[model samples]
Every structure is written in C-alpha cells, then in structure tokens.
Target: MFTGIVEELGEIVSVEPHGEAARLAVRGKVVTSDAKHGDSIAVNGVCLTVVDVEDEVFTVDVMRETLNRSSLKSAQAGARVNLERAVRADQRLGGHIVQGHVDGTAALLSREPGELWDDVRFSLPRELNRYVAEKGSIAVDGISLTVTSVDEDSFGVSLIPTTLELTTLGARRQGDLVNLEVDVIAKYVEKLVVTK
Candidate 1:
C-alpha cells in the first residue's frame, strides 16, 4: 500500500518490449535508497515490483493487463513518472490510503494558473464519477490532490507550487493522459452498502 505521496520525480530510462509485456528501467534515487529486489514502488499510480536494482535504477515488468488499465501503455524511455515508496507501518499518513491500483485514466482537459496555484481540469471516467466528490482526495499520476470541483463529466484540482515543481502533473500538457486512483475508502463503503 501507499499514501499517494510522491517522493521523487523519476525518469524512464529504457523500455524493452516482450510479447504482451514490457520491462521498464526507471531512474529514481530517493525511492531506491533502501529498495531491494521484490520491493514495491508506485509508478504513476501503478504498483510495480522491483525485479532488479542497479545504480539508482530499477527494473519492473509491466504486464499487458497493467498497460491496458493505466496510462502506462504509452510510457516510453523519456517519460517522467511520479515515484513513491510503500508506506511503513509506523509512518504518518500524509495522504489518503492508496492501493496503487488505478481505477482508470483521465485526460487533461485544461489548466488555469492562479496567483498562488493552478486550477487544472481533467476528464472523469463515467464509471468512476460516483467515487469522486468535491473536497475528496484523488491520486493523479501518483500525487495526492484534493478535488476543487466536480461535474458529471470532469473534475478540477488545485495545484500548489510545490506540486507544480515536484510531480509529473507539473509538466502535464493539455490532452495528456494521467493515471487516476480514487480514494479506497469510498469504494469499500459502496461495496458494503451494496452487500448489506
């Protein structure tokens, strides 16, 4: 599990394609500080296992299912990815609970810069709309952000300067694809209500 707090902005060093799967070598220093083989790393909201680690670079296999579910299908060597290590048992929860399981992908619709922040809008998948609410937390490209507003088809998030300079959201352009993981608690509540 993760807290949806991005630790470092990493770069995809290389991508080697195999049949129905691909191997990605990502370069991240901070997240790899104590990482070893089989450790989990959240890359753009997708939980990937470390297959090999060498010199601040780690390799993970991206399966066909992962590629199909998230924005990783378009990931290439030069892509910038938000990276976060798994949350420890005794650590504080700086962000909401995130399973690194992306519910779906969203497209950047527009961005409006404010005096102290930027209000960015993204298209919301219809199936995921019920889980998103105004003032609710959502993980966008692995960075936890609060929803400023939400419509039937889209939602907006206020990005502070720190977020603008730290994560992939800072460099995201209009129409770019981003991985989205909604709050896990909301989903669980919905499931329990249905079963009750």
Candidate 2:
C-alpha cells in the first residue's frame, strides 16, 4: 500500500534485460534512506520488490506482464520516476488507500497553467470511465490527485506548486503516457452493482 505521496523524484539509473525479464535500478535519496533488500517500493505506480540495494540505488525485476501493462514498457535510463516507500502500519493515511496496482495508463492531452497552479487533462480510457468520478481520487504516475472534473473522453486535475516541484507530473508534456490507478473502492462497488 502507498499514499501516492511522492517522497522524492528518482531517476532510472539503469535497465538491463535478460531473456524475457529485465532488471530496473532506481536511484533516489529520500526513498532509499531506510530501504533494505526484499522491501517493497512503488516505482512509477508499480509495486516492485527490492532484489538488491547498493548505496542509494535499488533494483527490481520487471516481469513481462508488468511491462505490458504499464508505461514502463518504454522506461529508459535517465527517466524521471515518482518513488514512494510502502506505507507503514503506524503511519497516518495522508492520502487515500493506493495498492500501487495500475489499472491502466492514460495519455496526456493538454495542460493549462494558472496563476497559482496548473490544470492537466489526460485521456480517460473508456473502460475506466465508470470508476472515475468528479472529486474522486485517482493515481497518475504514482502521484495521488483528485479528479477536478470528468468528461466522456478524459479527466482533469489541478496541480499545486509543491506537486509540480516534487513529482514527474511537473514535466509531463502533451501526449506523454502516464500510469493510472482508479479508486479501488469504486471498482469494488461497480463490480457488486453490475452483478446484482
């Protein structure tokens, strides 16, 4: 579990493939302060277990399934990633519950800067429309943000300065791909309602 609260913006230091699998190494300060081998870390919205830790860099294996489902398929060295350590038992729930399981990926459609913040619009996959709602929570590229509004094809979110400075979202360009995780509660509710 994670809060979508990004601890620090990390860089993909290296990516090496072996047969059908690959190893991903990420380097960051805040997130590696107490990390150990076998720990779980949310890298760009994907929960990966740590297989190795050296200095501030840690590595995880990327299975074929993970690559196919996320923007990580195109991840490369020097790419900026949002990093979050697994939520602890005694920690406060600053953000909504996030499983770090990406439901899908969204494409950035446009961006509009405002005096105090910026509003970003992302294409909403038709299959995920029912699970997203205005004012509801959504995780984009591992950063938890509220849905400012929703439409037939996409949704929008307002980004504060802090969010802009601390996450990869600040650098998102039009047409960029981002990982998306809808509210888990919403998915469960929809399942029950449709089955009735």
Candidate 3:
C-alpha cells in the first residue's frame, strides 16, 4: 500500500523493450536508499516490484497488462516519473490510501492559473467517471489530490504552489497523458451495492 504522497521526482534512465514486456531503469535516490529485490515502489502511480537496485537506480519489469493500461507504454528514457516507496506499517497516512494500481490514463484538458495555485482539468474515462466525486481523493501520477469538481467527461483539481513545484502535474501540458487511480474504497462500495 502507498499513501499517494510523492517522495521524489525520478527520471527513467533506460527502457529496454522485450517481446511482451519492458524493463525500466529508474534513478531515484530516496526510494532506493533501502530498497532491495522484491520491494515494491510506485512509479508514476503504478506499483512495480524492484528487480534490482544499484547506484541509486532501480530496475523493474513492466508486464504487457501494465503497459496497455498506463501511460508507461510510451515512456521514454528521459521521462520524469513520480516515485514513492510503499508506506511502512507505522508511518502516518499523509494522503489517502493508494494502491498504486492505475485504473486508466487521462489527458490534460486545460489549466487555469491562480495567483498561488493552478486549477487543472483532465479528461475522465467513461467507466471511471462514476467513481470520482467532488471532494473525494484521487491519485494522479502517484500524487494524491482532492477532486475540486466533476462533470460527465472531465474533472478538476486545485493545485497549490507546493503541489505545482513538487510533482509532475506542474509541468504537464494540454494533451499530456497521466495515470489515474480512483479511490479503492469507492470501487469496493460500488461492487457491493451492485451485487445486492
């Protein structure tokens, strides 16, 4: 499990494509400080296991399913990614509970700048739209943010100066794809209600 709080802005050092999967070497000093083989790390909101860790860089294998579901399918060697180590059992939940399992990818639709913040809107997938609600928590690129508004096809989030400076969302432009993970609790609730 993860708190959805970004710990570092890491860079993809390399991407080696195999037949049905890809191996990524990411440079993240803090996340790799104590990381070992089999440890889980959130790369851009997608949870991946550590295959190797060396010299502040960690390697992970991305399966075909993950590639098709996330923006990582088009990830390049120099792309920046949000990194977060899995939450320790004793640590505080800084953000909401995030599984690092991205449901789908969305594109930045628009951005409106505020004096000290920016209100950003992103296209919402039809199936995921029902899970998003105003004031609810969502994970975009692994950084937990609250939904400011929700419509049929898109949603908005207000980003403070800290979020703008700390995460990948700050540099994202219109049409850029980002990974999104709706609240897990909401999904579970829907499942139960539907089966009743």
- Model number with the top TM-score: 3
How close is every model to the real structure, measured as TM-score?
Answer: 0.98, 0.97, 0.99
Could you give candidate 1's per-residue lDDT for residues 67-168 as a string of tens digits?
998999988998889999999999999988999998899999999999989999999999999999999999998888999999999999999999999998
What is the Å distance of residue 22 in model 2 from its true position?
A: 1.6
The deviation in Å at residue 62 for candidate 2 is: 1.1
Ten residues in sequence with the least summed lDDT for candidate 3: 161-170
Per-residue accuracy of model 2 over 1-196 as CA lDDT, tens digit each:
9999998999999999977778999998888899998898999899999988888999999998888788988999999999999999999988888998998899999999999899999999999998899999999998999999999989999999999998999999999999999999998988899999
Which scores better on lDDT, 1 or 3? 3
Looking at model 1, how many pairs of residues clash?
Answer: 0
The lDDT ranking, best first, is 3, 1, 2
Cα-based lDDT for every prediction: 0.94, 0.93, 0.97
